[model samples]
Target chain A: MKIEEKDVFKSYFKNLTLRERAVFEGGITLGALFHQFVGTPVSLKNREILERSIEESMKNQPCVEDISVEIVGNLKEDEYVSLEGKMLDVKLKVKVENTVAYLRLRYIKELNYPLMYVERIDEE
Target chain B: MKIEEKDVFKSYFKNLTLRERAVFEGGITLGALFHQFVGTPVSLKNREILERSIEESMKNQPCVEDISVEIVGNLKEDEYVSLEGKMLDVKLKVKVENTVAYLRLRYIKELNYPLMYVERIDEE
Candidate 1:
């Protein structure tokens, strides 16, 4: 993410109510993990390893109540890492403040960007 | 968008504060427009017409405070409409709750879908 992008997110997060902020933090965590895997392999197993690491990492973030990462990529080893062909699917189920944001992302092979789109942002 | 997806978004939108709700309405409008352009031409001028229509349509939405739509696609007329090889960019700037959300989207050529990503959600 660019500096400007981070700044904007920070600004928005600060405006949310404490509970809401906590919920949004889950989205941020998933986004950051996706960022770390820009050139990584796009296989199911590789995604699992990354998911484990991310879940472990989220333990320290107070706002994260729960998180689940599902990576879906079924490509051969060679094509999996190549930037020319293949998109890594990253799905996240995050819960905070009694709210859940179901985010789905396609890790850009060329840009390595992860856009945690809120396919479902819910309050319960 | 799927029926489930729309339901999820509707539930979330109902929970937002009125002002926040207004701002978010902008994203929805842009998303709907992006959906309408699927299988359509990817030319810059074609995008302009669609953008104009979207902006005008948004006026009827009471929650819409202000909105701007920018479409970015520079392909030949023939190559533009073909779904196989192009991404149509739809950028939206929405104002709400005394805040602004900068959303960027790429209309999926195959799926004809729009994922309005909040590149930046800010409070000013």
Candidate 2:
């Protein structure tokens, strides 16, 4: 975002603390990642590109410092299935001024949900 | 979710009030909807099905009572663009116990952001 555009964007979030903003944005990104791609067709042929595409597209969100996405599980060559939440393991980094938040999205077997949670936070 | 599965899911959210839980789920759904479908391939041929598919997939998320998705803007016969956030208009309803949260995800021209916000909350 340009300086002016960034200012306009920041204006909507004035009520939130930097940490709150960071987590809020992170939550949105993780949720978006899971929901957006959950049903996409994936096979060995498109798996790498799909992972890369997910990372690149999410980078467009505000304050994203970096992201890594992995689509886990085994696939046989001749078939493709709709991607499932359990198949995704993702790490996301979001920065808000001096605070950086590390967030993750992965399925928890105990809960049977694709969970999004804050892994850690750092102030620097 | 089966009775046992639902119990495990509810255990994780014991810390949040019903209202907060409703909104939190709403936020994730809105964020997920935007990010998941933003880059999907679309054209006149597949627009309606794509919108329906998006709605059905999101319904699998916890607490999603109902959802409506519209892919706005024009598409020509032979070309398609990566789905942009600005092209989406969505209304999501999430229920937590007796509270229902109505949320919206749409582009705000003035802010130039696809803003996701709580439109209203009803307790019944």
Candidate 3:
């Protein structure tokens, strides 16, 4: 049988090492990102660049490649418009060895740039 | 055979629900607290009070109480001596239902108070 990212994510905590999960407590508290607001028709060009950046960052994590892992992180948009811009959400999937991890996040705008803030990372 | 907290923490990520683990990534980054510096001979009385506070916070978390969870948050000291103060360390253990979780943290002096900053939370 073949395992997928969703499977790895299902036991999200179990798939990772003990050291990895222990750090999660702090991660849950610290890695919270709110929504973002940028100009109209946010450039897909910018989004693609950022998506690649996120993927690279995830791949750079320790032991990610150790167990035959595959990560797919996408930036999704939310429906909230005002004087600001738009709010983008995330859907991240990671398959490690025989486990899978799928999570979500948020994209917020800073003074002049966009930041992909991790909202929450868990399986549904 | 009886399972202990150590056993649960060994598979820290695997034992916890996906949703729980997902929130941990953000928690790891956001819940980081730096060590604090108060007056001389920091009162153990204050430490107990703070420890209780931390336990309450952990207990209040969702799904924690669902299982048999025993959380022990302690304030340990470091060998950092200066005109300032001492740094404290933590050893936390949580038993969620059947799974156990053990993690570490740091206690730093802020302004004039003590703040418990989660260092690296993982079973070692």
Q: Which number leads on TM-score?
A: 2
* Model 3: CA > 4 A from native: A1-102, A105-124, B1-48, B63-88, B106-124
Misplaced by over 4 Å in model 2 are A2-5, B1-26, B35-84, B87-104, B117-124
TM-score of 3: 0.30
**What level of docking quality does candidate 2 show?**
acceptable
Give the best candidate by DockQ. Answer: 2
Q: In candidate 1 chain A, where is summed lDDT lowest over 10 consecutive residues?
A: A1-10
lDDT of 2 by residue, B2-120 (tens): 32237656765655566656765776788988877788899999999999999999898778899999999999999988899999999999898899878778888877767776677
Residue A14's lDDT in candidate 1: 49
- What's model 1's overall lDDT? 0.48
| Better-scoring candidate (DockQ), 1 or 3 | 3
| Candidate 3, B-chain TM | 0.33
Candidate 1, residue A110: how far the Cα is off, in Å: 17
**lDDT by residue (tens digit), candidate 2, A42-108:** 9999999999999999898777889999999998898999999999999999898998878888888
Interface RMSD of each: 12.6, 3.8, 14.0
Cα lDDT listed for each candidate? 0.48, 0.81, 0.34
Candidate 1: tens digits of C-alpha lDDT, residues B16-83? 55334433344445434543444554454466676676567655442344556665555565445532
Expressed as tens digits, the lDDT of each residue in A18-81 for candidate 1 is 3344334444454345434445545534656766775677544434545665555555654455
